[model samples]
Target: MRIARTVGMVMAGGMAMALAACASVVGSTESEVQIRTNPDNAHCDLSGYEGFAASVETPAAISIPNVAAPVTVTCRAPGFRPTSYTLNASADGWIWGNSALFLASGGGVAILGALVDESRAAGKSYAEEVHYQLSPDRPRPVRARSRDGGTDLNLQAR
Candidate 1:
């Protein structure tokens, strides 16, 4: 009987240590942040803007360390307007749940097993990345008119 009790206690201690290790491994206390241009409209042009700038902010920025990821950037020349958009970051790196373990036997052993299983199963982790962009708008130029029976000069801006 004493030997059985000692074995149960040792098993419980091992289970506790395993649960703690799993929790620490899955948790993400760090994150990254950066800047990038919109991949879809890369070829589009916005050369005629007066000024252009972009910025991004997030709640995790203050909480997580080393959050640096660029979403997208758009710029325009003088006489142009500004445009901006937000992007949601992906959460592929997060671990949402835990694995379960079962050990069969008596009433007292079952109760201790329940405690270990509950603690291990309750673990969770979450992470996400967000993106944003800014751009200036430029209106197309108007066509010129002809005078004095001269030829009309209409050149399309490329």
Candidate 2:
């Protein structure tokens, strides 16, 4: 019984350590995420961007920390419709590796070990690239021919 218990403890420790390293963090804490807008040079503001510059013109790159929360951004350009979008910060898939540790770690220890691993590794990250599309303030007229032959339909802009 003593030998069995000793072996179990050692196995648990090894499993925990191995699982910790398996975590594949998609992006690093200081990874730079490029932010761009279709209109270029537009003003852009990002939320939850760690300590890096939260505000910058479109076509700019900024470093953001890895976090579980999604990042939000708003972009605006002259004579263009302001646009807002969210960046997905998904949890690392290697977290599943922790599940294998349950047999060795028993219960809470496995979960705690996994959490510790994630904290030490990349926690979360915005995508490598974020792009936003903004539409012009005024809708361009569409040229359409009337069903009555040669007549053109002219719809005035509101």
Candidate 3:
């Protein structure tokens, strides 16, 4: 009888451990990122995102993946010179995935997280609000000054 009870308890413990591994302590596969621009309404593109979530508009919010590489954000607005920025993903401590086995949620969640949410403190991905200020491009129809003390409009197109 004693032996049978011990075996049952051990089986229960094992089941609990397996469940813990499914949980992650940090960032998930799908994360939220906010995009903002100084003037607003700028076109934004996430160059490194693997799926359809590659692009959005300024003042936009979108979901991103934790396991994917850092993404380059490109922004462009009319009359403003296009600017490029980057969003980085670092490894999260929870990536160890072994902690989950101990019910710490920081362990053993690596592979599970990778398969499900990709949770890892340093390995996990998080989003930061990306903002940019676009500078105005030079306008055409520039004027020229001559040494003879005369100003001429070069609109004739040399």
Predicted model with the maximum TM-score = 2
lDDT of 3 at 130: 61
Off by over 4 Å in 3: 1-5, 8-16, 19-27, 49-53, 96-123, 139-158
RMSD of 3: 6.6
- CA lDDT of each candidate? 0.36, 0.69, 0.63
* Residues forming the 10-long window of minimal summed lDDT in candidate 2: 21-30
Give the Å shift of residue 44 in candidate 1.
Answer: 20
Model 3, 8-127: lDDT tens digits are: 989866765555434353335556778788789998877664553477777998877654567777888887888887678765555555444445434453345445434332346555
Error of 2 at 155 (Å): 12
For 1-158, candidate 2 gives per-residue lDDT tens digits of 99999999898677566565345432354447898899999998777634333888979988766552466788999989888887766655555666666665576656765667566545445567877899888866777788879888877562
Number of the top candidate by lDDT?
Answer: 2
lDDT tens readout by residue for model 1, 1-158: 99999999899767654543332345442334333333323221211112322333222232222122222224232333434333322323222222232232223433453444334321221134333343445445557667776877775542
Instruction: Report the number of clashing residue pairs per model.
Output: 18, 1, 21
Q: How far is 151's C-alpha from truth in model 1 (Å)?
A: 28
Models ranked on TM-score = 2, 3, 1
- Estimated TM-score for each candidate: 0.32, 0.63, 0.59
